[model samples]
Target: MIVRRCVGLLALPLLLGCCVVHAAPPRGFDVLHYSVALVPDIAAKRVQGQQTVRFKAEQALSTLTLDAGTLEVTSVTQHGRALAFAQAGQQLHITLATPLQRGASAELQIRYHGAPAFGLTFAPEREEVYTLFSTSQWMPSVDAPDERATLDLAVTLPPALLAAGTGRALPTRTLADGRIEHRWRLDTPMPGYVYGFAAGRYQQATQQHGPVQLRYLSVERSPAQLRTVFARTGDMLDFFAERAGLPYRGDYQQALVASTIGQEMAGLSLMSEAYGQDVLDDADQIALMAHEAAHHWWGNRVTCAGWEHFWLNEGMANFMTAAYLQQAQGEAAYQAQVDGWRTRLDALRAKGADHALVYADWDAPTADDRAVVYRKGAYVLHLLRGELGDAVFWRGLRAYTVANDGRSVVTADFQRAMETAAGHSLQPFFDEWVYTAGTAAQ
Candidate 1:
């Protein structure tokens, strides 16, 4: 999160409204891995890359397509042999010379050059660069949140700057052209939307919390401020792990850049310089940080089956921030946070702008629709906690999270977990609150 990935859904008009920008992946195979090597021209805002995709076909197939937003494909090859390819609209149609049969596997190396339309920034003035959303904009690949695969990134940049990304950082090497290539690998499978990178001249500080490595980086703020602002990093991790009964064993990082982006990748989180300043002003401005950190459990680990149940990711994260407040900042602070959500929910209700937390279509959403996902969704959790005793509510959450770790889930999956803990059906409660425009006033 950094800014909590609502994306300018309020201020800007989006066709998909923070939903899937990636089209449905071609229907024959599952993507197993992606090896992306990129050379970004910071001054020109142009990038060139070689994308190697490995997949296994479930059925016999001779052609496939990938969502390649405005990329100009130069070549497509298998091993050393060329494959026929064409760029149509936002898709790259690749025709396999050697057709894949049922249960067969193949790899395609696609070379492309283009200026990214969105999701990546190259601020040459400040000498910083980062990605926000739309992984397809930066790399020509599927951006669906449910499509999971391993990744390897090789970003070539100047030797002096640093690079932080989605996976474990491997050794850096000097390319023949004199630029330094930063390499990273994600051995575990994660959706492409969580694949990203950030590179700049940053002052990095690292610490170890249990088995997890906690790294903090900043370009504008002093190293002391970087540590000061993220001092609660380890505590948030401990709180979430304790609450979920699942420890985060991987490395984590928070890098401050120019934009107000708080988007989380697999292991790296890009925060904004503005938020760091806010933390400097008030050390207790940790709610936003807490919300993003909570995504490590709800959003990134146990993803929504689809964007339709995205509240399972965002609403749960928002409510967990309040839960952390209840623990760290006292019950009054937690009640105040809940009261703020109530205010927002009441406002939405007043405007007749309330929408179901479990929305059906993400066609075009108003800012209030987005608010319902964050505020009303959290309020419903507060209501659910009230209905089920504290012990049962927490037990249900632990059951749901532990059972669906590293898996995709829908709203019903959560409802069943709560019902199991309560030893009774909560279907009536969900039918009234979650399935409809929430009961904000009641």
Candidate 2:
């Protein structure tokens, strides 16, 4: 999800970001998988759904909590037997009939129906899309960035519509009632924010880049237009892989539904329909593509531990995108990108929107804070690279990605990796750039 400051509003205090330090899976359990079956009623702008969550108890417990948002809960069952459940706020607490022992595994099946509080979108006149952090709006699961789980999604929609979701698509099944069920499975565990589905009358185009498959899903643009817009996807993937010293993690990756909101999922990304217009110049489009593609390694593979450390994901992606520009376009282009970010960041601070990078209020991050998080965050990394020099900088980055693969991390985790690679302390650098407000010296 793109972070834009909420203008004309006072920003929340930085202390609020501390309140959600433990906003992950409860200590007693770990989610293993999620199976969601949703049928969207586009005419009514609602969804009827059932979801099953399989989890393992890390400690004995008689109750479990999952993020279920505000969906009306009709019934909940465990092992085919009915169980009592309560919906409180955005959380669903289920009472187990028997106490689950540590290390024991179990499943809870939830039946419910309602329009999503947010996330799922139904636009028959346009397209149905789910943006970031909206996964819990339609289904019940552990919806936190630190909590990762494999997913199996079966979305039933009109037969004329095509759907794209996270992971690889399974064989499509047409129901007798002129509805189609599109199934997708993600074997690799991914954070919930990236879990999503987009369904509409979309045309698809595919390109193969070694073992990585690239699919473009769009309704407003032709296949050729999509090719022109995303022509550098394969090269970006190759560039990131070589630079990070890690192969792409998933079998296939998809870019779906045009929107101005550009977000990175595990193996998928979303582009806005504005891409089809001549509004965004080629350089801007390429930069956007490169930024999201770099996220496959920075944001998707090595996720941030919480919203507080979001820079670990977005900032790294921004830096990597600049790195790509430096290589593909030239040093002049790379320097211009860095200068642009510095200029924007200086403007935000000039307007009295000053916040520390590491401690920025994530609870309600404003667009001004986003400037610091995305642009200022990139500048921090750039400063570090300059301090460490090219040889150690790339080595440190590769080591950081490799060390944190398939895990969530905080800024300190990245600092340790970089320090280890450079064999020197980076505490002063982080303190000046990340922990304190104001721009780093140019």
Error of 2 at 145 (Å): 1.0
**Tens digits of per-residue lDDT for model 2, 1-442:** 5743211121333432222232433458989999989888887888889988898999998998877766888999987899998888677889999999999999889999888745666665764645454577788776557889999999998887877788888999989998899999989898887787777788778888788777777787777767767777888888999988999866545455645467777677776667544422453447777888898888888998766678888888888899898888889879998898888877877888866776635656778878788988898888888999999988988998898899988777888888898998876777667777745347
| Candidate 1 local lDDT, residue 267 | 83
lDDT for residue 375 in candidate 2, whole number 0-100: 88
For model 2, the superposed segments whose C-alpha errors exceed 4 Å read: 3-26, 256-258, 278-284, 438-441
Report the number of backbone clashes for model 1: 4
lDDT of 2: 0.77
Error of 1 at 117 (Å): 2.8
User: What lDDT score belongs to each candidate, Candidate 1 first?
Assistant: 0.81, 0.77
lDDT of 1 at 24: 30
What is every candidate's alpha-carbon RMSD to the true fold?
Answer: 4.5, 3.8
